[model samples]
Target: MNEKLKAYRAAILHSLADPSEVGIEQSYQYFEDGVLLVEDGRVVKVGAAEDLLPTLKGVEVVEYRDALITPGFIDTHIHYPQTGMIASYGEQLLDWLNTYTFPTERQFADKAHASDVANIFLKELLRNGTTTALVFGTVHKQSVDAFFEAAQALNLRMIAGKVLMDRNAPDYLTDTAESGYADSKELIERWHGKGRLHYAVTPRFAPTSTPEQLTLAGKLLAEYPDLYMHTHLSENRKEIEWVRELFPERSGYLDVYDHYRLLGARSVFAHGVHLCDHECQRLGETGSAIAFCPTSNLFLGSGLFDLDKLERHGVRVGLGTDVGAGTSFSQLQSLNEAYKVLQLQGKKLDPFKSLYLATLGGARALYLDDKIGNFAQGKDADFVVLDYRATPLMTYRLQQANTLEEKLFALMTLGDDRAVKETFATGQSVHRRG
Candidate 1:
């Protein structure tokens, strides 16, 4: 018996390529009755159970009936400090930040509060079937310290950074250029490339950061080997106008970050809902990525994102819940809104395409595809088991699904946290439905 090995038998599916690049039929692989083989916290293989079961002489196989297994969902953009204020009432981008976000983030100055919220945040992600996320902390250094401590305790692959807001924010939540740089550099030194955890140099947005702070953020990326740059971009029309007013020398909103040398393969900009064609082309040329936060955009009256335009320009895109303004922690809910966003633009979001955005697309956007996305051999075995019969209505609806695509579409449209039966990270069960 190989005690180090574990296997799960279920209906398994995973994305192999983008449907936009490969045809829909060739974008994914699925097995009606499949076996996922794991050993020592990594994937060994995934294939039909009939072909795999006979080869396993003395390994234990956990069978999940009426469930589908797939790679764990990834959230490319979310604010961990704003977890407490998720669904806060009406206000656009700027007002929302001043009203709900800043006040909520201020509490993170208390290490205990930060730790408490970190616990709740991670649990909620697992409950919603999310295993990896690029997160935001408050301006307080202790906030990131607390978050990393909690994430380390669980051995999860998470990325986060302390916010850098020098101006255009409440005084209580602001940090000077030097202080922000020193704090971020210290955090990068302590957390980046530590176990399964990474660090992101998070400047709140172009409007919040001064040229000096943005330069320092670029410096941090230059100093570190694999550090990430996470920030907001072009979410609201007024926000764009404000950015233009702040940085009059720059051509546009994206140029402000570009002039500071912040564009790169590891950079992720959230809510690029209002970018122009030139901006999209520059992003693609620089190999930068965007976190498509559909729910937040719709909730805040931000404009619809042009996923087709971004794709046509060769940009990489991922799904982001953008919690606090995003209205839901479940990626399924994000996908539901994303479907509507694309529909409004007269574009179709194929079920396979939606699946890719939530999983492999997110991994590629984060530049961690080799480690966390899909069931590729030697990749971390992070996955979720989804119960098709999570509710009576869902069960009834799925029974009428005539094809796999229809079934997947129904799951995204009608599902929420309830659809997540279990979630695993590194081959270990981290969440199980009661």
Candidate 2:
């Protein structure tokens, strides 16, 4: 009976547990006809519409007859500065970075240019039903500043950091150990824990950063206990060899970061495509997470991620578009690529598990599950409304689905940005499809 409450009626589904840990039947909850109630940007309740509708006296419900509502998608790793260069042609990881990524990121040295891309990048996320992301900016401090400004204006829960790269790259994009540390500290003080924004100490990777820079990056983590440490790991074969050459004293690629004291509960490493069993075990033991970027792996010709092996080692895994190399902003597309990635290795990615990785799994990886993932009471009301009939093909395909699992499988296989009918952040509509 609360007048301030807002209600929406739709078919709702959300992940409650990882299907890899729990059986598929016990992993998620679904309501054929559900009602989500919100007040002051928080979920008040979510239940079957028939049960909740009868209890309300005067609350108006916004109903979507042919749509599904689910927790907002989360992208665990993305480069905000590379939004313009997605799908840049035919080079593997190292060459691609030098050819496209570094040059494109250099443009962010201009605050105005960074601000302009931030606006477009965020809107693209909303359009694709992604409400939260762990983003990477250029070495330039202004890139992080501009990215945070746009995120704050939208009231989005976002984590970003300035790239810390000191050596083995173009001089134009490099930052000294002292300068990188100082700039990152300034950004953390200005933006970390400011509303829904958080800071990450970002080292490009083991090869780009010297031991001095890596040590200082770890020091930042010690200085701010709640901050995140984000970086790339074992994504490509050449990159792994490069790490070995750079840090021969270390045991392996992960040991370089480990030697610098970088692995922890808040650390998130992107593209663990080439990780060994020991590396996976260490990641789990330290509570570190990995971003499984399927599209980027495929596009860059990086090896397929052994998701089954990672799960066996008890490591937390999440979905990352890894755009521009990732090729699409849609989590559905990421899920689609994920399915194929698993298929190549003779493993299966069930539809429930796919949804979990994109939503709750990503949140857990980013250590924000308690605040933003799923439709739990008291969590932020960030969710997406997806239309089954978004396109002629989708409408036709969904009509053939016999069960919720079948419907979800079809959506992940065929859906894209067009399937996102509307996106809501904090219970307020932020994007509506034309």
Candidate 3:
């Protein structure tokens, strides 16, 4: 690799493991004045500035004074096609989909419109310091193609798939079982494993896909075991009831996918707010993951997600800004909502754990932990630079913080896009705050 080496100097913070598994101090790595060395888009070394600076004598060094550097936030689940309709008028999940989501997604059938939204959506993600996400595209193959094209241009590590909804959706937004399978296969071949891009086989959910469509989706998933399976689970009570009505033969909503062989280590279901004990056990045993969309759940009147219960069952969970239903693109804002949601459940979400969910936990949920999460040597050099004194309120609050925990608490509780001073992808500066 003949790539030039670059060194970044700043305060560094990252999670090495789940706080629950290891104590806060053991799982958290922080250096007051740190230096991260990168070459060919991978971390070469990370440690105290005094230790690494002397070694990087000839490398280019970029310094950010008093800023906190962390792994770029990972959104475990988000709908890229819903960029235009985020924060639509309040409605329940099913109604919200019909009133706002389906219609907005229908426009993506036009490649030009798809490309336009793709660019804007990606920039918005970068602006919010989210370097990676498992995104949902529209039913149109062009939408997924356009999204991948935009991400590839920026050398971003993105996972996306064209949605498959063969029934229970508008004609313009649906595809038959045969067509859905074929389209997903074509897209998988064209985009999966290309540079930093990967493809997930996306079936909208049990409600949108018929029995035949679900079976075919299962076949596609089985064919490419490495690809991710993205879909919804028991997000809303009404949606769950409707799924039971549709697949009465199955014991529960999650069983519908399990019966079709879609439950696995690579499957990541969104909005598992109302799942039962059996569902949680099944998800854990299969190594499946859930993208807990607190903002979207709260916006759509979905029930509270029991993080303690999920963890007790050994189920893996990550945070998502399920945009459109979710109100913000910023993971810090998402963490803000997650904190409240857990509070309502009579549980306290620790500040350290909150940061873990957006970084390492999200990568673990997507089964990409080995590649992108944290500042481990040989990992991809994707991270964010946060300015603690970004706003007047934060500047005042941070002055009172004397400990690292206190500082991180202030960042998650009070920070947003303005806190993101810069975003880096593969050792390159992708977005700098203007």
Candidate 4:
């Protein structure tokens, strides 16, 4: 009954669990005429409009008709420095890194360039309805500082860290193990847990980092156990072979991180496209996570992710755009690619499950599920409003969809940034379509 509370009315939907694991009925919550009440940057109440309206006297109501409101999309893995180089033609993982990724990332050494790009990158994310992301910065410590600076300005809940690489990269991009550790420690002290921001311990990958640098990265994680550890895994076969050559004494690609004490509950490995069953088992047992980046995988010709296999093995998985190599920033489009990737393997990614991966499932992967994933009481009020009729084709398709399932399927299959009517973070509107 506070005057500060704001009420948003729309058709609401959010995931309770992975539908592939739990049945759809138990995994999702949808309300046709829902009212989400927000106050002081948190969700105060959520229920049928008719039921809550009587109790919300004197509150400002924002009406969104024929729109679907869901928890804001969370990108589990993305490279913030690669925003400018997205969609570069040809080349798979390793080559793509050297040619497009490295050259673009090298520019981040300039503080102004890093600041400018961080502003653009976060705006692009807000435009696409992504409220939170696990991001990667360049090797320069300034890049991480710049990114967190921009994010802090907007009061956004974001996670990012500087790339740690001391070998197998251009001289301009490499940092010594000691320098990497000191830089990461300094940045973490400055930014980690500063309001809504968090820090990630980022080792680019096993091949790019020497054992010394990786050991230091593991040391950082051991020191800050609550912080996140993010890096690349078996994205491509050649890359895996290179990792084997780099750490020949190790049992495998995943073993390199395991041996260095880098595998744990707070760790997230991107693009586990060719991971073996043993690797998956280890990931599950250690409470680590895999970020399934279908858009990047298909664009770079990396192998298809065995989503079904990973799930069956009890591995926690989430969705990512993996920009630069990834084709789109839209999580809906990411879901579209995810659906196709599974289809090629004769498996199905349910529409509900795809949305889950983009939202709650991703939060779970980042170990932030209790804070930002759903419309649970007292959670942060970050969400997106989707215009089901954003496109002429979507309008027609939605007209014929009678059931909620069919309507949701059409939205995921046809939606993109154009479908995002508005995006909000912590009960404040950040981007609204004209």
Candidate 5:
């Protein structure tokens, strides 16, 4: 194909294949001194730097010395409107939603506000080295429009939607059931595959949406099963009690979503911190994903996620910085806190698994695995370069690191936006050190 194009040499480390692949761990990094060749923003060749360098005698290069390269972090769930609402007090999920989330999201009805937040939202993600995210917009169509508009301008792979809440929310923030379905359907038709943007059917949760609205949400998902489904699940006990009150005929919390045919490989739930064994079984059976937002869970006093039970169930889990309630947009921070979340439950989340969840696993959970998750040949050229010596403490520890795993563990625990030296999307430099 026209002999390819732009090339760069760096310390390249891509999750070369799915972690389930035979040689994923050892081969996670393709070449220590690696050459990543890109043509028209798509990766064409990946090999040893020394080998590929000689072939391209006069091409421009952006070499990152001693920087660790990995796939750009993929955030499976985040609320763009909640960007400024992070770090608010309290632990109850519902209270936090009503107090901070809904109020801030209400501002999205103003296009200027939506646009401003959308710009800041993307900048925060880029600063933290996340190239792709499944985001939630407010119940306003302008919010979805404003978000997609910003993503389109910035060329980010953003999946978002108009939040659907037909009842139990502030009157100003709610849409009627028919309007919810219609607005979402229109969004699907207009933005589902526009540019790198995709649409998600975002029902706030069972409590806010009536059965009619939830059923329409399932129908919309059925019409575009390829698109992602984003929502909340059993994040708290009181919330489960509220769901039972909302849908008394339901067997359990997750059954509320399942009753409407909203269970599938493409379905993704956020903050499943308190999901029980039966719920996990159904999620596993349907191949749906759970987005672990540890910081948010902790911020709101939600209990520790049962990582052991989830692992045993073979549930597909991904990492998220559920911004606003989540406390930070850094997936590195998500990885850091994810370790603590597991530790509290008497389980350990290995460093590799943490990083993998941020990259490939997150992409898989969103069903974007075939597209932008990892850096194998023929895949989209998305990469993040980390400066190992980004901070004084980290630099000191890197010298004492016994293995790549040790070095990575140090980075995950200590790293933040400072560690991100550069971010690339489709082989284009989206962010770089100042």
Candidate 6:
């Protein structure tokens, strides 16, 4: 029998458990001098350096000295087609979709364009230290195919779907109800659970989907066990008003999805800022999570999300950089911006809480906590190693940090892609540099 190759000598720091389950500080396990043994694609063992270092016999070692290692950031929501339209001029969510998003998404009908964007999108994600994401694709079926194809090549755990907007969108972007479900189901059968890929049942928003179209989306969700549902909900007051006009028979915005049975664990609704108290309660009760896209909310003049209020609603909240609308791709930047977003709401948000939202919080939202989002024994070794002194300012700032939290706090506020020293996925070296 052939001996398995091994890579050792990597710093190990990961969420020990659900921070929400055990207060944030206790939830993390960081080994100052640590070692991870990787064989094949999964993490075989992780422990202290003194114990693991001695086992190295003819094995390669990646020693990222003084670099802080943590699980890769998980983005709960983003639009793959919006890669080119991320920083377009000022407009609210609805208008932004019409002027920038719809026009940009329409181009996905071309397979070449989709493939090109897919490649660039995945590169940007890896560069920004994001290992997993729930992405939105154009209504074109090719868009999902291209995105999944790119993710597969990169070996990323990506969740995305074909947008379904049967009405209330540009004619070019809209698809018949039948075609939307069929294409989505086919994509699901092909990609869901296929080598780190998961398909999301995507509806642009309640206003754009007819009762029948939404019902069809709900049907798809019911049929596919373990599949995720993605959509926009109560993002803006104007959009909520439009939804009210569209679904007046329902009690509120969330009710539309609730009635369709789309409110449950693994259902991710982005930009839930305007959700009422009752709506928040429903989301919490149903176990549906909200992706708090602080950057996009601020970029589009969207209202600040009530994270404190929503968590009280028992809603699991995660972070997102609603790209294009979201000012940056780096989850570090998202954490930085999320701090200010909560600050503006007169809430006291500690930096650790911010980091938790980006990492472990997202894992919980996606229900992938058991697998990714942390570095534990028997879990995938998906983490990014960051240089505390990645830049001149960060190097200078390191002097002020005496403790781990202080160092991490400085990193979130003062870091970007340049801070990523190395990135690893499933025990493989995907990005390495300082």
* lDDT per residue as tens, model 1, 1-434: 88999999999999998998989999999999999999999999999999999999899999999899999999999999888898889798889888888889888879999999999999999999999999999999999999999888878999999999999898999999999999998898899889899999999999999999999989888888578999999999999999989999999999999999899988999989888899999999999999999999999999899999999998999999999899899999999999999999898998999999999999999999999879999999999999999999999999999999999999999999999999999999999999
**Candidate 1: global Cα-lDDT?**
0.94
Off by over 4 Å in 2: 1-3
Span of ten consecutive residues with least summed lDDT in model 6: 1-10
lDDT of 4 by residue, 197-296 (tens): 9999999999888889998999999899899999999999999888888788999999999999999997999999998889899999999999999999
TM-score of candidate 1 relative to the true fold:
0.99
Q: lDDT per prediction? A: 0.94, 0.95, 0.93, 0.92, 0.85, 0.85
Candidate scoring better on lDDT of 1 and 3:
1
Q: State the lDDT at 245 in candidate 2.
A: 91
User: Which candidate has the top score in lDDT?
Assistant: 2
Q: Which is the winner by lDDT between candidate 4 and candidate 5?
A: 4
Candidate 4 clashing pairs, residues 3+ apart or interchain: none
Q: Any runs in candidate 1 off by more than 4 Å, and if so which?
A: none
All candidates' TM-scores?
0.99, 0.99, 0.98, 0.99, 0.95, 0.96
Residue-by-residue lDDT tens digits, candidate 2, 1-434: 56789999999999998987789999999999999999899999999998999877788799998899999999999999999999899698999999999989989999999999999999999999999999999999999999999999999999999999999999999999999999999999999999999999999999999999999999999999999999999999999999889898999999999989999998999999998899999999999999999999999999999998888888889899999999999999999999999999898999999999999999999889998879999999999999999999999999999999999999999999999999999998999998
Q: List residue ranges in candidate 6 displaced over 4 A.
A: 1-11, 18-21
lDDT head-to-head 1 vs 6, winner: 1
**Model 3 CA deviation exceeding 4 Å by range:** 1-3
Error of 3 at 21 (Å): 0.6
The regions of model 5 sitting more than 4 angstroms off are: 1-4, 17-27
Tens-digit lDDT track for model 3 on 1-434?
A: 22388888999999999999997878889999999888889998889999988777677888998699999999999999999998789998888999999989989989999999999999999999999999999999999999999999999999999999998999999999999999999999999999999989999999889889989989988798899999999999999999989888999999999999899997999989988888899999999999999899999899899998888888999989998789999999999989999989788988999999999999999898999889999999999999988999999999999999899988988999999999999989999999
Per-residue lDDT value at 168 in model 1: 85
Model 2: clashing residue pairs? none
Task: Please state the error at residue 332 of candidate 6 in Å.
Answer: 0.2
